[model samples]
Target: MTGLLTDVPVDIDRDAARRAAAEELSDPKYRDARPNFLQQIGQWLGEQLEKLLDGLSSAVPGGIFGLLLVLVLLIVLVVVIRLRTGKIARAAKAERAVFGATRKSADDYRRAAAEAVSAGRYDDAVRDRFRAVVRALEERALLDVRSGRTADEAAAEAGVLLPDVATELRQGARLFDDVHYGGRDGTEAAYRALTELDERCRRARPVAMAGS
Candidate 1:
């Protein structure tokens, strides 16, 4: 038994065996199968964030329970932000003027609208073009220049005077409300509609009333 054991020379030491295994696994196939740089970065970041959160949670009295509570709070915050800035945006348009309280003339508003359209800010273009329409009506004595008059009020008042373009006026008013206060993205179609409304209004004469 002693001779047989002595004859069997175990040349593979522990460190040497480890080295051999490492070299074998260092094959191009193994390296190619590993994750790329971006994937590795993402994985490392996830692991670091996990470690940080776990450490924070462990420091709290409720440990993992506290981590759950924090995650819930974060989710709630995101939801609230979406509601405030993304979905509902702000309150009714009545709280503001149709022309945004600016004292620009109808021509000035038209120029402003053109600039906004050039800048690709369709929302601003729609607002400015609609304001130009309202201001033109006021200048021509078609509608009174009342303070705090909303888009809806302006459209209704203008419709009474300009019956031919009543529907278009109401549509432009709704577009104004939809884009400005309803958290909707303005589009070129909406801007063109307003532009057409402005042109039609310019040529429109007041409806003849029985008393007049």
Candidate 2:
């Protein structure tokens, strides 16, 4: 048993072992260890930030162009809306003027008829009176008297409240039309009819307003 133990060679190279260990420690691979997980994540984050800055620098011109396009479109939209609003306002004003003119015309015709009857200017009275009534009815009632509407047609559209004076009103229009268009002579009867029609229009004004 002693000889068997002696036969087993015990390697006692302590100095060599220590030298090998020191050399390994001094090697660059051993001295510079791989970074830990936290350090590696920090390095990766820095690289990504650099890449994002590069992308932003490259896209600056395109971003500016897009902004300008949006601004131009906004300006055009504002101009179009302004022009449309202006047109609408003008149309409203024109409608008001037409209505006001129609009322004034009716009053003028009534006054002219009264003046002619008082002055005994039968021919002039009949003509001026007829024109006044026609202007009023056309403008106020929106009737197209210019296309040569008959006296009965004009009276019906006038809707003058005085149905009792309908005949006299029609007669006045007929006399005016005959003398003005048909070259017939104006007379005393025509003047009388004009005066009666004017009186009827004054009475009927309230009813016309109600209907309107």
Candidate 3:
């Protein structure tokens, strides 16, 4: 009886086992069992991008206003600087014009004195001619050569470069002083001295002009 049982067949359905295994694998719960790391990372990146966009939108208006304010301030500063520079430039030009006019007047008077001496106008030479030369220099602000200044004082202030001519200038001034204040008669000698002084003034004019 034990030997006969060992030769008996067993009933097993292989197709049914395979069909059940396929059905279990095809279930929605089984198919979606594992978490997808790539999908999760994609979702996180999308959320981060939305937050960045929100922050930029919130800041844009204020940033634009600040940039506009800075631009306006810079423009105003440039305009103010330009205006101030123009005012200063105009003031400088006016000063130069005044100085040039004064210099021209001084040169003209010097020339007139020279002409008077050359023409042998002695009486006119001592008074109008020599006086014109001194007045012109004073008017141009070259020196403080005034009527009140003594001949010696004027000559001393005139300096070493003008020493040779300084004596002649002093003599002319002395003659003018004698005629005007000292009640002395104008003579040919006084006239000659005036002519010499006029020559000295002519020579000194260019030097003074150059210095100015």
Please, what are the lDDT tens digits per residue for candidate 3 over residues 133-164? Answer: 56554654555634344434544555344555
Is candidate 2 or 3 superior in lDDT?
A: 2
Give the per-residue lDDT digits (tens) of candidate 1, residues 65-153. 98789889999999988777663544433344685545799999999989998999998898888989999999999898887788888
TM-score of each: 0.54, 0.37, 0.34
In order, candidate lDDTs are 0.87, 0.65, 0.59
Give the top-scoring candidate (lDDT).
Answer: 1
Winner by TM-score between candidate 3 and candidate 1: 1
lDDT of 1: 0.87
What TM-score does model 1 achieve against the real structure? 0.54
Q: After best superposition, candidate 1 residue 19: deviation in angstroms?
A: 99
- On the 0 to 100 scale, the lDDT of residue 4 in model 3 is 94
Instruction: Give the runs in model 2 whose Cα sits over 4 Å from its true position.
Output: 1-104, 110-121, 138-152, 159-162, 205-212
Q: Kindly list the per-residue Cα lDDT of model 2 for residues 141-163, writing each as its tens digit.
A: 53664543555566665645546
Q: Residue 50 deviation, candidate 3, in Å? A: 99
Q: Which has the greatest TM-score? A: 1
